[model samples]
Target: MDFEELYQDIVLDHSRRPRNFGELAEAQFHAHGDNPNCGDEVTVHLKLGANDAIDALTFTGNGCSICMASASLMTLKMKHKSRAESGELIHAFHDMLTAEQESEPDKRLGDLRVFQSVRRFPQRVKCATLPWHALEEALGKPAGGEVSFSEDTAG
Candidate 1:
């Protein structure tokens, strides 16, 4: 199959049967993010291991295919990553989606690169990024986790 077909299949598969789609009872960090424009909502749960490595992560939410797929792929990519590494990935992802000049997907993004095309659709960019913003919020603070994004605020 062609690359476009493969990418679509991967996205569809993840959206239909998202990985790590649940809650964590003993999570050290958790945060919720919502997009007011499209009504996408997601909560990210994270458990850190030795030296702030990501021990486990999951997400719970309802959104469009792009959002669900992104959450799924992000959970898979973040397994066992350090907090610093995850932060880098978050920045790379944001840059990939918002860059004024399109470029090849960053190698660091792994399977999450499937969403590269999302940048072309400005509206869908928010859908794909809602879960990521939630993840970022969970990592940014120690308590009282919540984040909200609108078309005006989200890049």
Candidate 2:
């Protein structure tokens, strides 16, 4: 199969059998993000090690396929990474999701390229970005004072 086929399969598989799909009963950091336009909401929970590495990451919420799958993938990728590394990955992924053709893509996103096509759909951008933004907040970034976005509003 080609890249598109593989990407579709991954997206569908994650959507149907999402990894990290539940809550963390004892999370050190908790952050929630919402896409009001599509009604996608997710709460990410993380536990950091003494060195600020990600000891654990989990999420619980309701959202579109893209939002949930992205969260699943994000947690999967975050395991064992230092907080700083996780922040870098978050930045790279954000650039990938928000970039226009003129912007350079981050190769580290790998299979996440599936969402690149999503950029074309302005309405879905929030769906694709919700997880990354939530992750950023969970990592203790300023995140510009709690992110709330709607297709109808500035967000």
Candidate 3:
């Protein structure tokens, strides 16, 4: 199949039946993020393991296919990753989605790579990146135990 077909398949499959969807009963950290412009929102939950690895991760949300699918893919990609590693991957993902010129998404993203198309639609960038930012905020609020950020997409 071609790239469009592959992208569509992955996006549809993930959005329809996202992996790691719903909530984590033992989540050590949690955060809610929203994109008011498009009304996309997600709540991310995760558990930190012995060495700061994300032993469990999940999310609950209502968003566009891109947002929901990206969140689903993120849980799969982020599981077993150290906090620092997760941070790095988050940065890389945002970069990949927002890059100014067309280029291949990092192979490490696997199926998530199909999101490179998001670059062409700046508004959707917030939808795609919302979960990652929520994850970061969730992880960052170690003391608070929970965090939230409604993206100010207005420029």
Task: Give the number of the best model, judged by lDDT.
Answer: 3
- Estimate, for each residue in 1-155, the C-alpha lDDT of model 2 and write its tens digit: 34353358688778788898787766777788877666788888877777878888888888877777788888888888997788788888877767665365677777776777666666677887787787777787433223333333464
Whose TM-score is higher: candidate 1's or candidate 2's? 1
Model 3 lDDT, full chain set: 0.85
RMSD in Å for all candidates: 2.8, 3.8, 2.3
lDDT of 3 by residue, 77-141 (tens): 99999988888888789889776666766777777777877776666778889999999898888
Q: TM-score of each candidate? A: 0.88, 0.83, 0.91
Cα deviation at 27, candidate 1, in Å, is: 0.5
Q: State each candidate's clash count.
A: 0, 0, 0
- TM-score-wise, the better of 2 and 3 is 3
lDDT of each: 0.83, 0.74, 0.85
Q: State model 1's lDDT.
A: 0.83
Candidate 3, poorest ten consecutive residues by summed lDDT? 1-10
- How should the candidates be ordered by TM-score, best one leading? 3, 1, 2
